[model samples]
Target: MKTAGGSDAAKRRAGERAAEDVADGFVVGLGTGSTTAYAIRALGRAVDDGLEIRGVPTSFQSRQLALEVGIELTDLDAVDGLDLAIDGADQVVDDADAAAHGALIKGGGAAHAREKLVDAAADRFVVVADPSKLTTRLERSVPVAVLPDAHTVVADRIRDLGGEPTLRDAGEKDGPVVTDNGNLVLDCAFGSIDDPDELATRLSAIPGVVEHGLFVGMADATYVGTDDGVETRHY
Candidate 1:
């Protein structure tokens, strides 16, 4: 079989990891992204293969995929602690693919708030990715999740930080891009970030902000798949 390549590659790797993890059967947290879509498909396969796990999709799109794949569904408000969360990062470390000490910018699919919510509820968060998504540093690709109604104002704040902030297109040509929570995503180009933890904290303090794309101290480990093989990193 051909390995996943290009933009679709990361999802393929992430899906494999999710497949392995989901087999044990526990409450699982799903993410949104091309890489994450792979996990969704894998979850469907797992269910088809007799895996028993309930899923809390981070976005409506993910929810639909989960249902299509036959993963059991549960309401976010009804769930307590989750067994594990298999997610995908926009970037990982080139060497170790570790999520720790690495800056993560997600919510490009506008699932930031829900993703963070599920991650926080999980005892373990494992981020799956391909090597190209890995980086020496984090925050270069800061994906900011914002309320669709207050986007322009929040973007202005990003500009105040001396960076160019662009409203993230939800890969659609019609209608405002809707997040699972009905928000918009702002892809901010802040260049190299020196303090990601601080930025995550500051962004969350903003009103009308359900959540930001920063995952600090949330991920416990990461599994990075490369052309050579898979590299595991524990936080």
Candidate 2:
């Protein structure tokens, strides 16, 4: 059985290996999550060692982490585009041989909207994670960012699509969990996503849905860390 500590170590190794893809003079999109935190730290060390690069963080948490690590930071508005983006996925849907043809479920941290924007702007989006995150099918409840006023309607729409939607409650607060963009989250449980592309399309067609956790065909490559070592797959 895999322990949490061992998985975390793998996450760190995956992050570090992904950070090696960063180069001098590149404008990078820093991702949000524990696994990506390792990448941020590794990038910081590279910066200190004379690698000239700038980072656009995906969330406040990532921004603060980057600042503490001495990484030079920039806003998305300040850059025309990103050379690379490194992120972590809550669930990855791809085989070892599959490169770019895959999907992902993210937003465990409520920053999916911002993450999608940064990732889409990047020339290459690299996913870093422990091998434990990979799955033959993405069955995690998909996170949908909805307008506060549209939650009920969106929930109904999700139900129409055969999904059970629940408003995500804040663990530390007394209300629904709000995203960084001041919206609400609906965790739509569909059991197993059979057609990710079609599901993503249907979710996007919802009026109040700002964004969905389904990252369909967005990853350029992924680095998965296992007990033996890190493995890289391109798509």
Candidate 3:
């Protein structure tokens, strides 16, 4: 329930807790984000201890981290399915539908497109985050990945949908932030999201939109870390 900026300790707690679910001989989807990085490192330690598992990284960052940690890497093409996936969210809220897991706003790192594919393929998807990432309602800017040539057109369509879209710029480089798939990101702010599913559909309806940050009913559980401990919420 905490909403302030999450401390480093909290992020580590949530991440490491999620990593405990990984088992030997399982195929795991390694997610991208600072919190998920801890989970990756933990898995690396497990591998060092002789726990064998294959990882399908959701982003270049995660792929590099997985290699650095010595986790064996595999692509989605090589695996029929994943046993589990551990990811992080920019913001999370309980799903509107009671039977569904939860709604999440991701893509703060511009990797949501690939993250979605890897996550949805897993039998179980777990979200690792600090309490600060949870919210009663999702209001963060939604990231929409679009083809570079279609960015302008997508922006116009997004504006017509009553949302303000800003092309995300790279912090350490010039020009717009380019995704690993060679797409541009539009961080669209829609204020408080009343219906995430409806919005997700609208966003996906736009041509050239590769993916969006709204993750509705995708998470199976969320591990939220606090200053002193961790809490698990099941959907």
Best by lDDT: 3
Off by over 4 Å in 3: 1-4, 94-101
Off by over 4 Å in 2: 1-6, 96-101
Where does candidate 3 have its weakest 10-residue lDDT segment?
94-103
> Which window of ten consecutive residues has the lowest lDDT sum in model 1?
1-10
Deviation from native of the Cα of residue 87 in model 1, angstroms: 0.9
TM-scores for every predicted model: 0.86, 0.95, 0.95
The total of clashing pairs for model 3 equals 0
In candidate 3, position 4 carries an lDDT of 40
Cα error, residue 5 of model 1, in Å, equals 7.4
Q: What is the C-alpha lDDT of each candidate?
A: 0.73, 0.91, 0.92
